[model samples]
Target: MEMNELKAITEGLLFASGDEGITVKQLARVLDVQGHTVEHLLEELKYDYDNTGRGMLLMQSHEVFHLTTKPEHSPYLKKLLETPQSTKMSQAALETLAIIAYQQPITRTEIEDIRGVKSDRPVQTLIARSLIEEVGRKEGAGRPILFATTKDFLTYFGLTSLEELPPLPDDINTDDLEEEADLFFDTFSEQIDQSNHR
Candidate 1:
């Protein structure tokens, strides 16, 4: 692939990898490039982010690199996290949250299977709002991260515990709960994507 295409794929992979980040070897394997080429592309990307005053930075630790918001932008990011209620959870987000709440420690694939659609945005939205988090990794192929509701979720919903969640209605319709989860990190990711080109 061309250098520009490689760079774009690298950026998208890093974003999709989320908090887990991605190793040079992984990028090389996926991009069909050499380690040095991956390194060079990363360096070039990092330099672009640095010089362009982008909202995100390419950060690496323990040989894994991920995209992260600039530290200087924490106040604004925190403001977004703090006021999640301002952007109400979409039906998709609510449905995803409900799934996670009832089936604590589930993987995104499982959530998606239940929802019959992708759950990335909703999961990201929940994590950004501190409503859900990775409790651990499920032991198996790829070892997907396991998600569970958080204390903040309990507080936000005025629930004493998981048991406090009311039983699902017998007539519940997944179709009715079908809406895009729109809040927090999804917006954050979009803004970062926009700033990178500015």
Candidate 2:
């Protein structure tokens, strides 16, 4: 097929994938082309979109490609994307989400340990919203639920995967023995404040 035709097909596939971009390997398999060819096509497509005056453009973040309308177009887009009918999560839910995001595959007991308070309501709310999920059962007696972020969580946060999470500051040493006590209080204090506000 012509490069132009392949580019068109690739663009459509990327659009259909939404926040998940097709890897060059995946695109090559589908297009019956070399991976390098797909990469070149993607670069060309990105250049075309960038150079054009289109209100929407193709962008790749965390190896995922998507067409995002410019932020300047928010006013026009909001009418269709939002209705005053959306359900906003409570502050408690946001805190719970942050904890789960940083320490996933953790059990409720672990979350409580980190938060120094009960997380039942926030955990339930996150699960109901399809953000966090029971990824597995712990090996211990009674097998407590082990929670983890779901694909919906990644999409909602505009991340391709957990690996795309931003780098943490090197100064914040998570393993420092001296800072352990302070870290616990800091994490739990935020949780308490969120709970009280909710």
Candidate 3:
């Protein structure tokens, strides 16, 4: 195929891969081209995005290439994400998020055990909002889905990384899981407020 055709195909593949991204080796194999040739094509594609001033850009993290929105568009993105309809996370959802944030990669059964209630609805809500995602599956009888927070979780809470979360109180008892979740949510909200002011 022509270089232009190859570039277009690569762009389509990147878009299809979503945030997971395609690796250089994967692309090379798929395109039946040398690794260096794939690298050249990726560079050319990156140049096109930079030169054209598109809202989307090609990002390569850990050797995986993906298409992502440019940072300059974050304000608009934030607006869309924080609109009235989407901004209202229910108390259950918040509790679920707190558990996922702290106890990942936890399974639904584990969350229910801590909360002392079935968490299917709240889990669904968090998944729908993209706050938490299925990171993997457990190695038990059912191989239950393991849940974890997504990058969007960090962005929503204005956290650069999970390590920035407030340390749990040393005196806090692990038996009071609900209280622990409440404290986590409170701390997360305060951090978000602080970040917004900056």
Candidate 4:
């Protein structure tokens, strides 16, 4: 096929892959072209998108290629994400998120220890909301999955960085996580509002 047709096909494959994206080797196999040719097409496609001022950009992560909106459009995207209809976090979710936000790369066990309750459901909820993710595993037995906040977490909270989060008390009272969650949520919500307006 022609170069333009192959480039179009490559772009379609990336789109169809969604968040999972496509790998150079995988694209080569599917396109019946060599890996180097796939790489060339990707570079050319990236250049075309950049030079043509397309709303989408090519992002490569760990050999995976994704077609995503340009970063310059984040304000519009954030507006959609912050709509009032968005799901509000439950008390349990808020507590769990607060702990994770402060003590990130923490395990579910550690979160449970602080909250003094099972955190499986809350962790799953955060993962589903794209607020937190399994960054990796711990060092010890069973090697439990370690969770950390995602970029979406920062976006949703209207924070530029984790440092922007309200500071935790010098002595966090783990015994009263319910009250702690309430206090944190109140402060956190205020910060979010402030961030959005700035």
What is the TM-score of each predicted model, taking all chains together? Answer: 0.70, 0.45, 0.52, 0.49
Q: Give me the runs in candidate 3 sitting further than 4 Å from their true place.
A: 1-83, 189-198
- In model 4, residue pairs whose N, Cα or C atoms come closer than 3 Å (at least 3 residues apart or on different chains), thus clashing, are none
Q: Largest TM-score belongs to which candidate?
A: 1
Can you list the residue pairs that collide in candidate 3? none
* Model 4: lDDT of residue 87: 55
Residue 71 of model 1 has an lDDT of 94
Which segments of model 1 are wrong by more than 4 Å? Answer: 61-64, 81-85, 168-198
Residue-level lDDT of model 3, residues 1-198, one tens digit each, is: 899999999999898765456888889989999999999999999999999978889997656788988999978977876686865666667777887898899988788777777787788678767889988777855456789999998987768998976677789778887777677667566654564455
For model 4, the stretches where C-alpha displacement exceeds 4 angstroms are 1-86, 171-186, 189-198
TM-score of 1: 0.70
lDDT against the true structure, per candidate, is: 0.77, 0.70, 0.80, 0.80
Instruction: Report how far off residue 160 is in candidate 2 (Å).
Output: 0.7
- The positional error of residue 122 in candidate 2, measured at the CA in angstroms, is 0.3
What does candidate 1's lDDT look like per residue over 1-198, in tens digits? 689999999999999987667889999999998999999999999999999978999998657798989999989987886783636666567778877877688998888777778788889888987989999888876567799999998877656887877555465554543332222223233433443345
Question: Of 2 and 4, which scores higher on lDDT?
Answer: 4
